[model samples]
Target: MNLSVGITLAAIMTIACYSYLWRENTLYRIAEHLFVGLGAGYSIAMGWNNVKTNAINPLLNDGQYILIVPLLLGALLFTRFLPGSNKWLARIPMAFLVGTGIALSARAAVLAEFVQQIRATIIPLNSVNNILIVVGTIGVLAYFFFSSKFTEGIPGLKYGALVGRYVMMAAFGAAFGNGVMGRISLLISRLQFIFGSWLGLM
Candidate 1:
């Protein structure tokens, strides 16, 4: 069967990776290392390209000196690898990055998870599906209520919390099933590629 070098190499790597499913072997280890090395090299090259085009060019050509602050901070990340007490200097940039990341992520998460989810749940109870959605949402929230013991609280809340627990279990189960289905789909696609494209036996 006719096969291009790229397709042949891809097939070999695919087989090598799948070989781990049976048992770890030298071929799988080689493929894994090759994949990691190529990925890291590509990431480094892309990062440098982005800094040159996006940051360096703007700072030098367009007189955007403020970019230097971020550049300096990024460079400080590597200082952690240096010897002695000087490694503490890296924490300055690390703390700044973590603080900003947390602030940005928390703000976005509040808007998306709290506000958007509440809005979505506040739908008209015009259908059975909408009713179930509203009930399930409330039950899930009640299950997470930790201020007071459920036994000491409102009488009906204990039952509501129980229902909420069930709802959460169902949600988790569905998520897990979906994940397994996705993995199976990937396996099917790989099998099709090996048999239909490479071997021409499908």
Candidate 2:
């Protein structure tokens, strides 16, 4: 009984969400608002649970006073609600959060992007595929040189930059196609759910 109700509700929501294909109507607005509200509520719940488990519970039960520092910084996040100069309190934690995030991400990004790319590109160019890979990598870099001297004044680099432009175009086209395919896949799944789960048609 409950399963049927859930499926019915899902089918209704799916239809409501897709109703914007015809025109933006009240049904689409309601579905959009409901989705936003649910997302916000879920985020709040998850954040509260995280704080309780990682900070509050540990501090209270184990007398871990160090957790109070983070808890206080987190509380500073709410100070954005205050007026005038007081709102600047939020900037303290915000700066810490941004700096920490950038520091951690930059470390990982250097390994993933620079180190991995270099490792991948430095392979022995014995085969045709390896040669293409190396050439393509050089071409892409040449394309982004920005200086006319390096990209155009240099003969080989000029051609490499042209190849790079085509390579970038192909990559962007592939990405766009993948995005379209993903949307189509979602539509197919929703249609299957509406027919098979709700209507028992398939």
Model 2 misplaced stretches (Cα beyond 4 Å): 1-3, 149-152
Report the lDDT tens digits of candidate 1 across residue range 92-131: 9999999999999998999898899889999999999999
Clash pairs detected, candidate 1: none
Among all windows of 10 consecutive residues in model 1, the one with the lowest summed lDDT is 1-10
- Against the unseen true structure, what C-alpha lDDT does each candidate score? 0.92, 0.91
- Residue 130's lDDT within candidate 2 is 97
In lDDT terms, which candidate is top?
A: 1
Cα displacement (angstroms), candidate 2, residue 46, comes to 1.1
Q: Any idea what lDDT model 1 has?
A: 0.92
